[model samples]
Target chain A: MPPSGIRRRPGGRSARVRATVLAAVDALLAEVGDEGLTLDAVAERSGVHRTTLYRRWGSVPMLLVDLLDAGTEDDWRAPDTGSLEGDLVAINREVHAALTAEPSVTAAVVAASFRSPEAGEALRRFWEDRYERCAAVVHRAVERGEVPPGTDPRRLLVAATGPLYHQRILLGGPLTREEADAHARAARAAAASGLL
Target chain B: MPPSGIRRRPGGRSARVRATVLAAVDALLAEVGDEGLTLDAVAERSGVHRTTLYRRWGSVPMLLVDLLDAGTEDDWRAPDTGSLEGDLVAINREVHAALTAEPSVTAAVVAASFRSPEAGEALRRFWEDRYERCAAVVHRAVERGEVPPGTDPRRLLVAATGPLYHQRILLGGPLTREEADAHARAARAAAASGLL
Candidate 1:
């Protein structure tokens, strides 16, 4: 391979650098949260020189934006639970687990978005992709005649998942998996009645 | 009047000082969005010395906490529209308007909560009081036979309004008043079916 081509190889040094850096970012967010997160800390933890961090990411918010941008967007897919209720419960369970997990980076990333518009845009992209992937759950229900034809996937999804977020993230309360399923049931009932 | 009685009078000098300072805090939050807010700015804008602000509030988050605590908690009450659907629509309209307002202090305050544990506690207090006030809407509906007996008011209220916060604050999207009512309708339907 030519000398220049070696730099572009899959799993090359460049890819490793990014993976290592983002992993450190994730760990820092989980531990220190958005308030404690800084590019200096990222460099110190990752052993990547501060100059490279400054030249590339430039700021903590940008680093956070890139961290979310590098998430498993394509690798994840909605569960096939064979029924609308089951699918919604499964989705809510995943969401609740993510939001309630110990030292969740998700909470930090979300908080950081408020501090920066670029990070907020990155968050929008993250949610939009997530909604796109989860749209499959609603489409499956439609095909199975579980919900009304043209029962909006977005509205149904927002209804199903919004409460868990409200209670866990916004309200800062204890949220059990059972409570999340209750919200799923409510969403299911609403969709069945053609309200959503 | 006794000297002590004069100092304790309603709307006295101390109350005026607090009111003026909190108003400045609100203005700064709306103008600067949490990032630009500082105690020094509050001092300068409110004509209160930084020493008093430091001795009292101590930090930006605490100032935010006090600002929310000074809201119209007693003056505001839920609307009595004689039906659950009507009451819910009215409540959602108010929430949508507050959230969608240009340079909304609400967005700034909600964002500030993430930066401090005290601010987060204050936010929980804010929502709890709001929920308590809105519970009247559901109770009246129960009395009017518009919904089932023993329908939980908190869950119903969360269902009605969580979508707007999820869309506008968390996901960073354009939320129209119509979409808010749709959520309210879903909550109304869910409550009627005993899902909430």
Candidate 2:
């Protein structure tokens, strides 16, 4: 085993290995869906040692959870466009782009969440963390007197994004830019009318 | 082979076989999820011949599609509560009950949809059909001057149900009856305010 006393660097070999492994997992998920993913395939595709992967991830679901966690870390800043409507629209647009840009990958990750308890827990945490992070936008809106003081940020965000998710994942509808805009506008209208 | 001239009854042996096969598919999906569902396993569980199963369903995805189709046929009627708000609340409550009552089955079917193109298409059709059947509620509301003429029923319905789905499936939140009522009320308020 490597010495535990050595301080790890941010962009060191360990980070590179993790990045490569996650990328391999992403590719495999896109190609074969979550049901077909295997640790051996990930090892071969990532050029990581099988023993290392087994020791680190332990199972395919754990590896998927790690991939999801890594995905959540990639720049999900709450929009601050001076108005709640602008921020809501921007965030909804971002979600629409992510879901539609790579449907297979998004679908596979969601399917994995439903099929594996570990992945499901990770996905739940991912959404909760995202909601918590984005709650600041609503807080700022409340401070600015743009919305009610007691407005629920998580509920508002869910309302803004839920229809988009329903259209893309559940109903299999075309997730157009206009649809994303409409979702944002609807949420904004509801919030302004004290409907949220 | 059976004679082509013989008329088939609705609930005859063929129907029984289909029901048994679909039930087996549902059971296996709940037990092991989409990844573990197989034609051989379904045949064994249903006590049906392997050749018959192959000839009828052909693949696991197709079998899942059949199961979804069967589910859709079981009594989904729009509530005629004489008011749009009442109807919306009733529908949302039903959605909440269905999602929470048998979460495993719902999760498995949704996962199957992500992993299979055939299942995805079937799921899409299922929602569309349900939407069509329930469009009457909105039409009645329009006729009663509750909602504006030319109101999109599907949009209203999506708004009412999207949050529940996001909470139950994506965010993994507890979908309570109060939450269901809240969703309906929010959508009703939004629609009344011309947000939806």
Candidate 3:
């Protein structure tokens, strides 16, 4: 039923099937909310069989988590912008671009993560990894005497992302490219002064 | 029908009824969640009839907004601690106490706020009002030569609250009294350095 010669393997085509189902689930979530997303709809959209979808993910939350797993956080490796200010501006721009690209999807994922513990755990890992990556960049800056060593890398990572999300949800701002750059400049100044 | 003598009039008695309904919604949201809450449950729990609940609030989100309205940010009057450091520390403690006292409620409200415009508007009003109030304190400090006049009040407010929420959600910290004091110190230092 799904695009020709794709028979189920006896050994368990589980990995491939999971990816397909997750893609479908992402599509469904983007179109319909958590309340409207159903296993049948996902199967229909993803081209995966209903049995396959159910066999892999037992519930909506579980399916959502799988989709979340498929998408990772943006790479946090520090930019070599030659200055702390330039590095922060690059990071902030990336964040605003990501959120703006998928506003509704981002909002739903955020809401889902808050409501489900499984989603939260996965989301936490994603954030931790991102922060660690970003922290490495800040570390280099400290070594170069750009910032004080006592700077909390974790707080800096938060400062980079916090304003974007805060303004997106709270202020209904455009989250435009220009604003992201401004945030980066501000955060870099804040951090360099050892204030953050 | 609601507890025998509880009148359901719109002006005086209805105000009491509104309060009772809001309390019920708060408890329900904290216990069950947004999806699980219903008019029937509110009626049964609040002892108000179904017809009355429907007549007052048109939908679940609307009801949630009303509950949020009842809990509006009223503690915005800035305190004069004669210095930025003292003022920030005192304000941080107040915020920490509020969030820690009702983490679940705050989480639910935040999640719902992300999805609903009404909730988002309510949240914006709440945070903006608080920020403006806190900014007034910073302004007073600048007036007294405690901090530089060029300091951005908006940025200062975000940095102050950022860590409190970060610890609560990401690090899972206690957001205790001592920690609030620490936050105040860091935020004030940042403010003084013109980073905030």
Candidate 4:
């Protein structure tokens, strides 16, 4: 076995502590959400000392940015369904599900962004990468001649998925797969019409 | 002058207190957004006692609901631009302006909804009334035969405005009046295409 000083060294010990504390961030978010999330609460939930939490994450806004930044490690990609319509529906379905989840992490993260400019900027980076990934479907559609060249993928994707976010996140209205598909179909038709 | 007890009695006194306290809600929201809002802070800012705040608003969610409820007292109406595309652009301009406001109350209210179920429901009513009012433009469009008789007004409005909210609030991306107009134009075309 390693000596006590070696076992308590920075590298592995710090990583384990960070992983544990960040997991507690999600748990707190799931329960009381971002409003109730505090560094003291995190320390209590994480079983890490308050000094360590303050020394590391420092503030809730910084913690929120870190939490969202972790999402960039995901291997998320847009759906490829051989057509723009199918791809839009597939993408919106995932978004709809995430937004509809009880104690939705997506909704919480979006809410967190509004609480601080730092978190908002981090959320922007996370979405930029996701949109870049999803733009592939538009490129594929162009290659397949489903839509003409110069069809802006980001604009089309925004039109396809925006209503789901608006309905689910802001209006707190009922959303369904049918409604998601309808927006996707509208986007597809508009794209074919050279409007989007 | 009337006696101190009579001067600070229930009727007019309570009304003034409520107004003053609610004004503080907006001040705090502007300075620090919803996450920084607290009853103690409100009491301190408004010169109302914390007990009065607790007895009246009770909780943060209830305060949020009341703050949004105050907006309904406004006599807002959709633009009468005499055309579907014109009206859509007009409505989106208002939405875009609010979301992009420095210390945007619109974004703060939307973010507040995610923090509590009560606030979410209040926001729903707020949006519902706003949408119902905006539906007037679509009725005018239908009368002008811009779209078919059965064209759903709500779907068209959502398509027109959703992307603006998505771009400004969620993506935290750059937005402009021209982009808002573009989405409006797309929704108009989609409505005309009999797809929306």
- Per-residue CA lDDT of model 4 for B21-79, tens digit only, reads 88999888888888789888998999998998899889877888987787776798999
Cα-lDDT of candidate 1? 0.85
- DockQ of each model against the real complex? 0.64, 0.48, 0.29, 0.50
Task: Quantify all predictions' global Cα lDDT against the true fold.
Answer: 0.85, 0.82, 0.70, 0.84
Instruction: Give the per-residue lDDT of model 3 (tens digit) for B1-196.
Output: 3544454443667778888999898888778766667899999889989888888897777787887666563344767778878777778777677667653676667667755779877766666666777788878888987778887776666656655666665434456676556556665665665554
Q: After superposition, how far is residue B98 of candidate 4 from its true place, in Å?
A: 1.7
Task: Report fnat for all candidates as fractions from 0 to 1.
Answer: 0.59, 0.53, 0.18, 0.63
In model 4 chain A, which range of ten residues has the least summed lDDT? Answer: A1-10
List the candidate 3 regions with Cα displacement exceeding 4 Å: A1-14, A20-45, A71-83, A102-104, A170-178, A193-196, B1-10, B20-51, B58-60, B72-76, B102-104, B112-120, B138-152, B166-196
Please give the lDDT score for candidate 2. 0.82
Q: What pairs collide in candidate 1? A: none
lDDT of 1 by residue, A1-196 (tens): 4667656774586677788898899899888877788888999999998898889789999998888788744498888889999999999999988898777777878888876889888988988888888899999998988899979898899988988888888998788887788789888888988888
The TM-scores of all predictions, comma-separated, are 0.87, 0.80, 0.75, 0.75
Give the lDDT of residue B8 in candidate 2. 60
Tens digits of per-residue lDDT, candidate 4, A121-194, equal 99898888888999999999999898889788888889888988988877777787877877888888888877
TM-score of 1: 0.87
List residue ranges in candidate 1 displaced over 4 A: A1-11, A35-55, B1-11, B27-55
**DockQ of the two-chain complex in candidate 4:** 0.50
